[model samples]
Target chain A: MKWWLIAWREIRWEVFLDRASLLRTAIFVVIPIFFVFGNRGLPGGQAGEATIVALALQSVFFPSLAGVSLIAATFTAEKENGTLVPLLAAPIRDFDIVLGKLIGMVAPVLAACAVTLAAAYALASYRYGAERIAHTLTPQLIYALLVLSLLYLVTTGSVTMIVAARVRSSRAAQQLAGLVIAISAAVFGGLGVVASQLADGWALVAVGVLLVFFDVGALEIARRVWQRGEVIGRI
Target chain B: MIEVRNVTRRFDGVVALADASFEVRPGEIVALLGPNGAGKTTASRIIGGILAPSEGDVLVDGISVRVDPNGVRARCGFVTDQPSLYDRMPLLEYLAFFARLYDVSSPDHRAVELAKLLGLDDVLAKRLGAFSRGMRQKVAIARALVHDPPVLLLDEPATALDPEMAQTLRSFIVSLRARHRAILLTTHDLDEAQRIADRVVVLYKGRVIRIGATSEIRAGGKPSYLLAFAGEASAARDALSRIGIEAQPAASEDGLAALRFATDDPRRTNGAALRALLDAGIEVVTLAAEERSLEDAYLAILAEARQ
Candidate 1:
């Protein structure tokens, strides 16, 4: 007898008008294209193309921000409209409220990430199919994709719900979400600065481990915030 | 059945509710009457399991709301005065979604049934964003009733409805009572409370100062008879007093002359007041027995309680 109708209701409006934050969805998919194939031969030997494909696979992190924004925006909008309390007043647990909202955002955001990555993979194969992607994709690479996406989601899903729950102003939420995106960009760029030295399979494994660590860390911090009465403390 | 025993809820230094105690029996309609910010909403929320009381126990059908909150919530259908319905979803889908939350299966028939009961059939497919205030209120009501919980906590159930629509809701609440659903209604409209509530609890500040069966507490002491004559106002008061009826001059100036007599027995006062005037040959132009309004009784109770 538990459900997420409130959360579904929160996200449905975003999907229906194609109005609520489609621009973020667009940016999430489009930015990876530029990094994957646009600038070639930056770090390695004549293996310029394979590195780009690897980077494209690694850039599964982009949609993480999209998920955060969707959850944050949903909460901010509901609080502004005074709909949050009535929705919360329904027969659901306090924690379940956050879970439903996170599910609403994370599902759609992850779906968009999957679709955009498919398009990116097809383009990469068309250009350098005979080389880095000579055969169909490898299990190791698929594992990396699956693990990275999972980590990114667990981290962002938790953090975004907390951010959404704590804030009052929609502008504040947007600005706060914008701050998170900025931080993510810095982290992404910081990885590039150290990429030339450790440019190999070892580096890919290292980055994968780091992403998982950060994902777990962010989720724990978010879970703590949600439990401390910050989510439903106010109106 | 619900029981709130000396529940006091405080935030920091602000007291939202203090030592508030009241009860609702099975199949009872208890309208919580108070002015804005009089802790009406806070008390209702505590009962609905949306908020916890600072220092008291709220028991619902023998289950404490704080200890087994899910149990308390499961038995309640909660509705706010305003519609915070999720936007973008069709009204019916939203209801169906809540129906699922209550683990309510076969909701297609249930939604259709509630839609007809609440007159929400016409707008079932439309998104809630498109509904008017009245329509939205109906949808909010539908959301609460979808699960058919044993208890209904309603805050201004018809706040947004028109007069006729409010009448419909009032009657619908009566029907729910017939179904043995205990209802807690909070509204500013006293007449509505007078019309539908089996009992009324008036809250002042944060405590329940007065409560009983609606008609009992508001039944004031007893009825009083009023007499009016065109001429000789003092002469009429003297004439009525001779017959052992206390005829105090209510309006003794100019063309209007009136006297008031307090009596526990309405029939005796009605007969004696009329006979004294008629036998004395006093010109009794208007004579009527005034039944104390629930309003007058309410004000007196409030004024006395505040003191």
Candidate 2:
């Protein structure tokens, strides 16, 4: 319950109220529309397929990067601003603070992904047709865009939070988060290419299951590492 | 009540705090005085449960910090030197956030009440970034009181405040003491500590070198008196010598010759010294006992510890 309170506060202040975050989310939401328009000249079947892949990659890549940066700032920014001491001094449990920040940082990214997917769908359906777009939006692609994307967000967010807590400054955390994003984009982009070439949705679903395991492991590591003393000492 | 029992903290191989122990009773303020890098903040953080001790423990209202740090934290309110606040958040929301974390029944109500107590009710809707330094500090104090914890840890609460604002904060802290809270204040401002603290704990190199009442620490040396005389220095010296007391020539601004002497028993020796001067026909313009300040005692204590 206290974790929920912390998450809600973070979402309200850091995501919704922060102008820079809003701008990043807005750019992500608008990026997929351009991709949909770019594929407008293809045949109906090919255009529908291209739109799905493009949307999936856009949904996973952009928002996950955003989530990584946001999560990276979670501890380092608080430390830099001198807020971490009072936060650590609070009555809330250490795990709750870490879990709350993880959830809080991931929530906005997921919301932006949802928006980007919806916009891509509407634009692709208008450019081609609803039937073709519906035929291309299979269950496995949905899983890839939503479930797999969520797991990826969790994994990256947890790792970034750990990095944020360990680094001496926010700028250093952001640079490290950029490195995380680069590695993630390479792995995810390779998966997208493999799934596209093999024309196999279940293979991506199998990968999705693997990600669930990775997500749990990352979260466990985050919980065990982030303690009040460790957080305060970095500050 | 807060009892810090032989708490030691180390960073890597170096010791930040070594076997520091002190107690702050309910309704009492114990000032933790130290110089830079003296581990005052480390001790405060350990007591507040933000940092754990390397050894030993701190008990807040009988709750051991090592056993239940969150419970001890629940009973304590820590005010750091900087008013580190969420500048984008409104004052009331900021207070309510902490109140909720502390599990208050009515967070909004408690936030408003604390704002009122700190005379910040009118600016509850304002964002913290828009406030001045003093107002921000008041907001920080209000945030600490949101849960009404019985133990308050204030680390240089009046730091960087103007004279008027510092006086106001000092008055407010005294008022908090009136409510029977155990207050541990770590400050370099010896004057402030002398004015409000009931007991003073001197920490040197992460060790508690001295702990006693404020008056006892200030009166670390024998009581001394300065006698300003209208007569010559030779006459004042001769009078004091006749009384079997040695006096040193002291500076005086009013064109009066001054002689200073220390006495173990001021009540008895002062009267005898005055009688000797009067018998010698020396005109004593002023006979005042020199007051030893906390700063003086602090320096002397540190010097002794260093030696």
Give one digit per residue, the lDDT tens place, for model 1 in B1-307. 8899889987666788899988998888998987677889889888887777889989988899889877888788888887787667787787887777777887777888889888788888898888888888888888889888889999888886899989988988999999999899999888899889999888888878788888886666656677777667677777777877776778554577788878887677677777877877787877777666667767887788778
Cα-lDDT of candidate 1: 0.74
- Candidate number achieving the greatest TM-score relative to the actual structure: 2
For all candidates in order, the CA lDDT equals: 0.74, 0.85
CAPRI tier for the interface of model 1: acceptable
Best by DockQ: 2
lDDT minimum window of 10 residues, candidate 2 chain B: B137-146
Q: What's the CA error at residue A200 for candidate 2, in Å?
A: 7.4
Give the B-chain TM-score of model 1: 0.87
- Give the lDDT of residue B44 in candidate 2: 93
List each candidate's DockQ score: 0.40, 0.73
lDDT by residue (tens digit), candidate 2, A95-212: 7888888888888888888777777777777877778767887666676577766877887887777667678787898899999888887887697568656645657667777877
Model 2 chain A: lowest-lDDT 10 consecutive positions: A39-48
